[model samples]
Target: MIATPYLLYLGHSNDEIGIKTSRGLAVFRPDICVGEFRHDDCGLTLGLPRLDFAAARDAGARTLVLGIANAGGRLGNDLVEDALAAMEAGLDIASGLHQRLKDEPRLVAAAARLGRTLHDVRDPRPDIPVGTGRRRAGKRLLTVGTDCSVGKMYTTLCLARALQARGVKADFRATGQTGILIAGDGVPLDAVVADFISGAIEQISPDRTDGGWDLIEGQGSLFHPSFAGVSTGLLHGAQPDALVLCHDPMRRTMRGLPHYQPPRLDDCLEANLRAARLTNPQVRAVGIALNTSAMDAAQATDLCARTADMFGLPCSDPYRMGVDAMVDLLLAMDAPAATETI
Candidate 1:
């Protein structure tokens, strides 16, 4: 008898994947030979009969699709390889199933529930600033990721406070209005942006003799679902003069052990540059904040030096360099064109 071919949907979160299956979405667990489908958001993995591609084909399954998140470019190569291996083993699977199958009602419902739960739990909408246009005055913006749980918010909060302490007028704003604000307990994104813009205008009012800068921080990866409006919204609304990319430097291991290693300086620089160019072509300079998860002071210093040289931006240890240094560095960088008009 010919082996049966099956479709597999792969994702990172076990609970989330299980919910997808409950909503009639075809999903298979690599550990089990069964396929599962479901229709609810409650977190549970149910096993279905092992998929037989021959049977599926006999059942008129014209195409097999596999979906995955974080599968683009260099990041998702492993998922692609694994899916290919399953196909080679006669599973008759499709590649990048998540995108292909996302249109299904069950999948859409599950996503909606997840979004609502997140919004209800964190009330992210309240953080969005009200105004839709660029600020009328010069401001400094700082962006940080909301994912990785690597202390991005903590660093951002610290920097904001430090900047204030140094008599620099800056306001903290979430990168994207969706997930970052939803994950927090503060004002919505629109309100925050409005307040920040108002603050900028006040600081640089035409009647005033001196003007101040505005600081905005971003949240989540550029491609993260929760970060939908971050890049474009920030550029269109806040018009940041400079960008500060904060990242954790702990080497991610397959075994989940935190290991100390040289940072991916080139990759970070290129990624930030690409993000800035894609969002707003006017971003003038880039600064980096490195989080030392397990590195010693000497290692952190060396890493900082190497990163600065490679990226042509100041690199500093968030723990050691302090927010004052960061603010000073940002002010010294040339302002972007958007700032000139304000």
Candidate 2:
């Protein structure tokens, strides 16, 4: 595992979504995060103490987490220099970019000379087997979305916590970099080879008989042309018995692709269910989770109510509003049908 007590490196990020890795860690694993490191011109903050490499190390940080998520996922020359400096200040380096830190000659040489570790969190293990498609023993719920960055991680996390609070055994299975950092373990499905993506997910979440739930975090949308393959692989591998559709109503178009419009909620849900049925024919949608960050309190509440009525399923903003209704519905699934199945 990458060392903790992290000093999150934000670099010079100005886009809020681009800094999702740092934001996720700060919100979900705050105790392990020591401080934030950014250029003077950077305006983002995680509400943590600001410190340089030396100060962060002195404050007991063991690693510097490169927490930026740019479009290309490339490790720029400036970032490489910062990583070298962090190692000099007695800290290891960890990254989840598409570019591997271990492959960078400069970073590799510095790490070896300094006796520091380079954690390429996005790197997949080599021994993953092809998906067997056999039924597993535990209950699972996957959070799907209408588009990317619509809070699938957040919804899964909330449901896991809520289930645990109700005296049920539950675990959050991370699938992406942000989720991986938050849960401390997961397969970076997006980084895995196309043929092994499903296999990687199967390895990440295997059979269990605790009568509990494995809340598997999701990746891209089935409608997103850029990431549909990853999403389909995750869907089949999860074999989820239930699903929670996540959406961001404020987006008029798919994230990063303004040319393509977001799919209608009905269309997105049906498409995901059909794809998921390839593994678990009984898989049903449990609820709807919305990222209502753009809405006021009243608007969020009203939208949730209308959505619940529209779909005949419990709907709520998993962050601003508690997912108690969804959790309750999930637990009561053994009873008669509370909602329609696909």
Candidate 3:
């Protein structure tokens, strides 16, 4: 069970992923959040209740979550000190940083002295073997995005629910902490050795020897210089039979990096599929998952229509438009196996 009286400490985590994490607290419903966080006053504005660290402790918040993304595993000294203080206060800490908390000797010793647990969310499982995706026996689907934080996880979840509604066995294979929290299991793809990334994916989605659907959550992007390796590794690792490209209509620039612009949706889709074909030439893109929450209804519909036209694939804002058409395509692809007599 997840320990609660949760207090998420956001140390100036104002970037796209951090902001989303703050707002997503409502979905997780932590008792209190601690920090001076900020974001676009957009609809994703964090409505999660906030409290000072002192007040949070007074109110009995037992666990402190590092609610920020330490991209490239970089953490500030000040943040480290703050975390040690929290551990001294008897708050078990949970972190998703690529840098494992247990590796920090000072923090590890502090937590041990305080008898508090440190959960490194990105820690990889033991004995992951090299991937032989050929051994899999499922109609796998992966959601690739134009860039990071473009709603890949949301699209995967939407597709999973849709497939389940159609009486198809669907599984969500998570690649990060947030997705792990939602699905209750997954490998943190970026944490795995570069050589074993695909092996990690293979382990996560073992051969059922049956053609059910597995919606593996895509990460990073082939276009993102920062995490392009992770994106490519997941693509080759998942070896998906069908792919869904996810994009955000309102995000004009790459998250975190202001000087950078996101790659075009069409170009991103082409690049991802081309890379995937290197391992499995038979991979086909079945749909596009568009994030349209920041746009008006007319704008969202127009973008979806144009995206569908360009890709010649079913396109929908999975959250607003529903994933029916996308799931319909996958269900059809797996028809032969799905209809087999037991």
Candidate 4:
């Protein structure tokens, strides 16, 4: 009798476990072509379509390994579902080979492997030096989201450019899961979140840069369920001088849909303000950035006005208003000597 090699079916393409599994499978079966199918905000579905059960049967791959993060937690549900779906699709899904990622607190170490080590790579605690005394000449601003993919990066980058254009020395950092890119200095996503709190503070503190540098920090969201990469957590760990909440107007009605929808101005503003208060109880002001992925000028402008009226904070279509104007609005809302210096 001849012995055959085993085949594994893994799911979830965003994090480390999935990456490692895919790489391992590719190494073992160089002939197999791997394909990734991702759904908007829904996560990824990975498969090996070319390799059939017959091949597996011939090769003795009758056993399959299913990868999962948390066995019973919300994150694990999708993995479990994928495994079941593969079985339903007639593949020999393995029963006991349910692999789970080790219960690590954060992804900092994983990120470091990707050359994105955060500041103080050794320490994963949230403790950090807070600037003492009064607020200095530079403006302190924070960018948060209603949920992930609400265009936080584009807005922050645009704001940075805008501040620089107006002669305001501006620096930006992200403190969420994705924020690891800045914290780890280009590390992988997993490792970045572990050390982001302390790394972000060290990166943004005036001591790290010249005077008059406008500092902006990025956050995922307070309510995001998966990964729980909330900006509110960052705010609690490292307090900022001011807060900016980025939101999508159509988040409620069109969520989980294939296409993007422009958010309603009033609804978006209200949701952002509520979420911001969850983090910064005393958020000095609020602002809105229209994600133009699904809207035109007239719709964006009308939504902007509704947001401005609802939140009493300056609003702009980030795609149209130019970054400089955003920075100017942020600067104008600064409260002198308002921060509790570290």
Q: Model 4, range 1-342, lDDT digits (tens) per residue?
A: 101133444443456553443433343333432322232442434445434434554543433333223333233545445544433433433222223222222323333343321122122334443323223334466666666667666676567667777887666554432232222222122234544543444444444224454445555555554433444445443344465667776566333443544345455435545544443444554466757557777888788877777667667766567654456666665444434343
Alpha carbon deviation, residue 82, candidate 4 (Å): 30
Ranking by lDDT: 2, 3, 4, 1
Best by lDDT: 2
* Residue-pair clash count for candidate 3: 0
Best model per TM-score = 2
Model 3, residue 217: displacement in angstroms?
A: 1.5
Worst 10 residues of 1 by lDDT: 115-124
Q: For residues 275-322, what per-residue lDDT tens digits would candidate 3 score against the true structure?
A: 887656668899998888888899889989988898799999988888
- Consecutive 10-residue window with the lowest summed lDDT within model 3: 35-44
lDDT (tens digit, per residue) of candidate 1 on 1-342:
112223433333355532332222232113222353222332334345434444534443332333323423122444444433333333443222223323334433543543311122112233233443433445556464423344455456556667777786655544322222212223233333434533322222222114455555454444334443443344344445566667676635311223522235455445555555543456655567778757888898899888778777777766566655567776576544434442
lDDT of 2 by residue, 303-327 (tens): 9999999999999999889899999
- Rank the models by TM-score, top first: 2, 3, 4, 1
Give per-model TM-scores: 0.46, 0.90, 0.73, 0.49
Candidate-wise lDDT, in order: 0.44, 0.89, 0.75, 0.46
> RMSD for each model, in Å, please?
16.5, 3.7, 5.5, 13.1
